[model samples]
Target: MTLYLCFCLAMALFSGPGAILALAPENEVPLHPTTWLGENKVTPVHLPKGRTRRLYFTLKKRADLMSVTVSPCAVPIEWSLAVRTLKDKPPKKPHWSSKKSMPEVWWRGSAREVRIYSYTGNDVDTYTGPVYAPASIYILRLKSNEQNTKVSAYIHEGPGPSGAFPELPSDPKVHILGVGMTSVTLSWSPSSSVVVKDGHHGSLPYHEYCVLVNHKHNYQSLCAAREGIRKERQNVQKRERREKPGKEIVWATLKDWWWQQPDALEDHASSLWDNPEDPGCVCRDVESVCTVSDLLPETQYYFDVFVVDRVNGTNAAYTGTFARTHKEARQAVTSLREGQVKWVTLSGDASSQKGEQLFRFKPRGWQQNGLLTLHTCNGTSKVKVTISSKGQVLSSEEVGHQLAQIWLHGGPSYRLQIQALVQSSSSSSISKGDSNKSKFCLKMQASSAYHRRAAPVFPATLQIKSFNKLRTCNSITIAWMGTEERSLYCVYRRQIPPDAKDIRHSSTDRCLDPEARPANERVLCKYFQELNPRRAVTTAVIGGLDPGVVYVFDVYLMRRWGLPIKYHSKMVRTRNEC
Candidate 1:
């Protein structure tokens, strides 16, 4: 666990609602300036088991209505809120009012939001008391059972705004600039709204825009995020129950039942809010062009451009746009004749160079191995070449002027994709018939002799000393300290029996020794090349392993010139079935 998580757990244990209120008088966890209720505030309250917390706010003379909303963060907490009006001030000790305890409300998932409103309006039918005065104070007392959770309390003391949303800006076209295997670049037009000047010399825009991007997810309000998550989980649960007719899986929302779940499960359920990079506003405050990267290939994504009222937090979302990224092409582009080499050139025009150009080569049965080379023919733009087979990338290299070589594995067919890294200066000069634009050449030649297997060189800077592995019943997570040097890392797994004893004493170098190597080893996965190279640590998640099996994992660091250096991890046994 990280220190940050430990600190949060410690705070949750000792913190209380009154303690938090003393820290931030104006709701410690404030929402945006403008929302549906127009600057309504919220506080994160932690109530201990069988405890009551009292909160109050003064009502101004201009306001005749008071609204207080409580939303439990998790579980169906048996909670209640009592409300009463005081002429002068709130009592030091809170006494129960006329409001009854809230009823049992059930939601599909623990992360769903449930709202309970204690509203007091002048024309409300339930109210029997005289009209509330301007200087009156409203005191609220909240009580909950044995559950630790954070609840948002929205308090507003004035006439609510019209239920209708504000007008949205025109010309909301989201252009798909370019798309890659794992990323997409998007741009949109900037919008302007009416300005509201304050009593002083400065003024602010009454409306602004926020750009939200996600994989097949769209939201119009804060509550929509949680609602969408709940509906998705509910559908999955329904399908699972249908598959297992004998099993009874109740969607329990009780506080007592919720505590029975493992802490890891709850943490995983709530990770959507904790992940800073999760689907959210990529651009705000009127910025136009934005790039939403790190997306999964062959998946559709929704981009929403919402017009937000800066003064009152009302959102007018334009009809969202959806685009699906390109998947790996299945058919081979052309056949590679044995003992013959062919050169293919890619032009720099926007039409030809917008995305990755995939070229597949099918070598004849006689050809066992081949060499693939790439180099720039003209212009200053470089290119990235990746060779893959059966959707797995064997090697990837970026080259500029000099030739770059990558050995292709023995296969029936392999795919080579070239992506031109055209500079911004040269993009403006590209034309349909221009010959001076960026150009590159690709050459694949069949080779008779296999590359020589050289002894591995363990560089002091790139050597792996220690690493950590987290094991579940069916998966393992391997993480190791990273180095500044850019390289490729691949993981391979081999299963051994539980009774094996001499495996630990076996020579690790036998992996590279052709005669002594084990044939059961198979590739699992690799570290993504798109991640930051200078990161402090690199992690890979390997799934789909048999439970109750002992496995050995090996990592190979591929060198540019010599053979790869193999690093062995401590043997790990997956947990037995529950």
Candidate 2:
């Protein structure tokens, strides 16, 4: 029994990073009986930074297990907890650099809410059988990080007052109940082993499940992957510029340029669709049946069902399947000659709140750009116009009473979708059946000359101008001039390595939160802002830097869909004196 307890203690002590402790002789202190039949006392504790707090308790009567619940207050904290008995030693200060020591159970985590440590279960979301022993005294030792944290502690007896951990849940079977334009309905059977006694007093047996929906489309992923490859190749080229011959380097550069063309990249992406990788975790719900909404239209999705045990917070994977949502409208061809404008009238039906009209355009030896315009002709309603090709939406706009225009690029074939919103109207001119319906006028024209417009189109050259005068030792300002009015800019910064004397930045680095990376290359600051109409140039400041350190800052222009474009980058050094 002692050996088994020691083994479980070692397992728990070495579970997390920087968890090391040497047990000492038990220190006698005032003891309180842990609550079993009644509510456990909630003792609020305020722990100073780099300090320790201990509470001693005794089990009224030992059965199978005991649980200690530490609920945090408003502040987030990095803390570790260790429980000891009279036979075992008390927890001493942990030597975080070593992993040789052991304790009855030690847990370390950063949390802003509740954290429960079970004496019976192995701390990492599983129950490895109980290794608990009866003791006259139990000690709770807590250590905090640099933050002065506050928490409430509750010690209880038994596997849990709520319920004991059940067996691993059976895998679930998932099926598509229904699918719509922007949503997918899924249903799955309950796991046989998921029944656990969970209620106000642990008297009810209930089943719990988690339904996961993952977006299976790879269009955006393909673009991001290509961008990464392009950046890596550019880096290699820069590194080999002097070592390699001029002729070979020129030819290699030309090949790289050719591969970057849209047609070539599309073809490459198509070839990779045979065996696509699953990008997990789009949406999830704690129900057997779920309807995921606000999804992309006419896209592929994957569904998963997991049998979960609420007591121990363990999940058993069941089943998953792929499903594609219905398209917005059916396909039909519309022929338009060069320099020709065609107009069509659409009638909204009262029976349906929304209506869709789809037309396919295959240009032959025509101009690369097309113009589409829409306006409500009769009744009060709004319309949404969408243009797509190869399952990729290029442009979509919502038009009300005024005329709206959308420009399209040249392609082998394109799909046009016009969706009308039917509004209720009591006008006498409208028929009774079509009383809630409306009429819209749609005009389509093809010509290179129509490309001339007042404002610059999006995805235009995004260039970063000079920085503003807001430079300081700890922060630097980034200034950029944009051609489009409504644009989102994202900036990222990383410390330059000392070995990199002649450094060049990777333009394809993903725009992610600094907290996502480890301490080495983590971004210390983030800046995201939309373009201000009143100002001609936009500027953002990045702070939190050490003096005498060189950092590289990259600016990217975010788009509504697909990957962002890397606009520019700069290298700045902080003032050493600061």
Candidate 3:
């Protein structure tokens, strides 16, 4: 997900940046468990008569977890949310096995706020999982964990543009549900809500959902049911006096162009459905326009919806995103500096966005707070390595991808901690980063392709068996059993050749063909076999020749059949006591 900015520089150069313009101020929002405090918001669905909406509230910081408990124990039902394992890259995948790792358990949690839908006697809604990070797509599940209640489920991406305005589904129409006065429900399947992009790009990608409301009246304006399943299209379109607006798709490859002056303005104001469509008489404007109808009137309601975007042309697939909204609007983001490695004591109103987020801390020319972005790859990881003045990582090698250390002229000789505030998975991971690990590099992407899986599945174990040394002279003999979680083990021989000094290149080619014995060494036998999916394979490697020389060797398992990629095992030395 990219950075969501408010308006523009004019908003910041004049009004100022920092906590004042935060959508969710440091004190108003839940503090992030692993990061510093900042802003957050729900998707919008603004209508002309903005009467019904949820109240916007904030927590101390971001919480690693937030539990939802429905009241009135008598109510019975089940609610579950599932995050796709295929979506976010997995953490681990063993090489050579050629199998993708699935999510922790397919789904994460099952539960929702009390307002989603209601339950009658003999029915209890049971939530079965945990909440997820923002912008993450998830499927909702409502089942009879206790039996008796019947309500559809859905996939929510938090909420987005549609949540603030209503529009007709271009293709397959959606079915919505209205719980109580304030609870909005939608039809859903246990399956994934957003259409996943299989591979490359070219096909139009868009997400779709059908919301099943509590009452048909909440969406249908027809005085009566017209047909059995398909409802007649609602007539709310009025002939346009001028040319139609929104004739073109607003292309925004770089987020910087989203709110850029004239470009975004055309799409934001010029685009227009200018009318209502099937089922609901909800009007469509360039921005948004939605409202609540008669359904358990006067009851507090919570509305959520998905915001769809098209990539390619007609045959495009579906991309998922959902958001929720409340009646109260929070302050817009002013200016911010998500780039500082430490609590930059220096300052300025540098730059800020209008309605969303993004606060740039650019310095004119020679200010102490030079402009820089403190980027990170695994915002959830608590590891960091310091970079030296010469650009070398001084701490652990895996702490960071690229590191850069900071130096102070006369300040305390201690490490300064600065949380990303906006990107950390939790405030804790963010805090763990705000350190002096003696040195550190600015956030950078990791280059190790070995760590690309969702869950890192490492080779479970290693087994080595020994053999008796050959009693002959000139060369000693050795043997051992070997096994690996992966395929193709590479055998290496490391021993100085007798004429090595005379050989300018020092011909110690460790990759001596396993089938052929070297002129400088001998091989009894060497070969690799496939490992069992349920278990590893065992093979023996017999050594020959070489009497008084000791040779140390290692086994490198292949993650891929022919790729240079490999994970090695501990060294094994051959005995030369013949």
The candidate scoring highest on TM-score is 1
**Against the true structure, what is each candidate's TM-score?**
0.34, 0.31, 0.19
Clashing residue pairs, candidate 2? 171-318, 172-318
Scored against the true structure, residue 135 in model 1 reaches a CA lDDT of 34
Expressed as tens digits, the lDDT of each residue in 1-578 for candidate 2 is 99999997787677743433334223321134332222255455777878766655655664666665554433344434333433333345544534532222222211121223433211112222233444333445555664665555555565634333223334435678888998778776655565455467635334355444445311112223333334545675676776656545433322211111122223434543333323222222234567667656887866555444443332344456778888885445565555454565666662453356666655444554555544354335577778898889987887774435566674666788777655555532456566433455545444333434332334333555445356667877777655334556656677876787566553323323233434554333333444543344667777887777787776655433223345545777777774
CA lDDT of every candidate: 0.50, 0.50, 0.29
Q: Write the per-residue lDDT of candidate 3 for residues 1-578, one digit (tens) a residue.
A: 12334444445656655534564442232323221112232122221221211222122334444322111111233443334323444334433243322222222222222233333322112232334544333333333343232221211122232121123345422234433343333432222324544667654334332221222222221101111012212221222223377554322211101111112123432432122123232212122223334333443322222222222100111121122323433333223323322222111111212211222222222222221223223323223223222233222222232222222111111122232222334433234454432122223211112222221233444333334443343433333333433345554555645553443333232222233434343322234443553444444444453665434444444333111212222223344453
lDDT of 1: 0.50
- Clashes (candidate 2): 2
Encode model 1's per-residue lDDT on 1-578: one tens digit a residue.
69998886678558976554565543222332212222255455666667666565544446555555454543334433333333334333335442322111111111122122343221111111222544333444555564544444555545553322334346656678887766667776654453344456544445555555555555543224344445555665677777767776543311001001112223434643332334322553455666666666787777666555544433454556777877955433555454444555666543553434667666434644555544344435577778888888887878775445566664657877777655575445555475655454444343332443322223333333323336678887765544355667766677886687777753243224222345556454354342344455666777788988877766666545333445545466677854
Count of clashes, each model: 4, 2, 110
Query: Which pairs, if any, clash in model 1?
Result: 34-312, 34-313, 35-312, 35-313
Judged by TM-score relative to the true structure, which candidate is superior, 1 or 3? 1
Rank all candidate structures by their TM-score, best first, as comma-separated numbers: 1, 2, 3
TM-score of 2: 0.31
Please give me the total number of clashing residue pairs in predicted model 1. Answer: 4
In model 2, state the lDDT of residue 466: 41
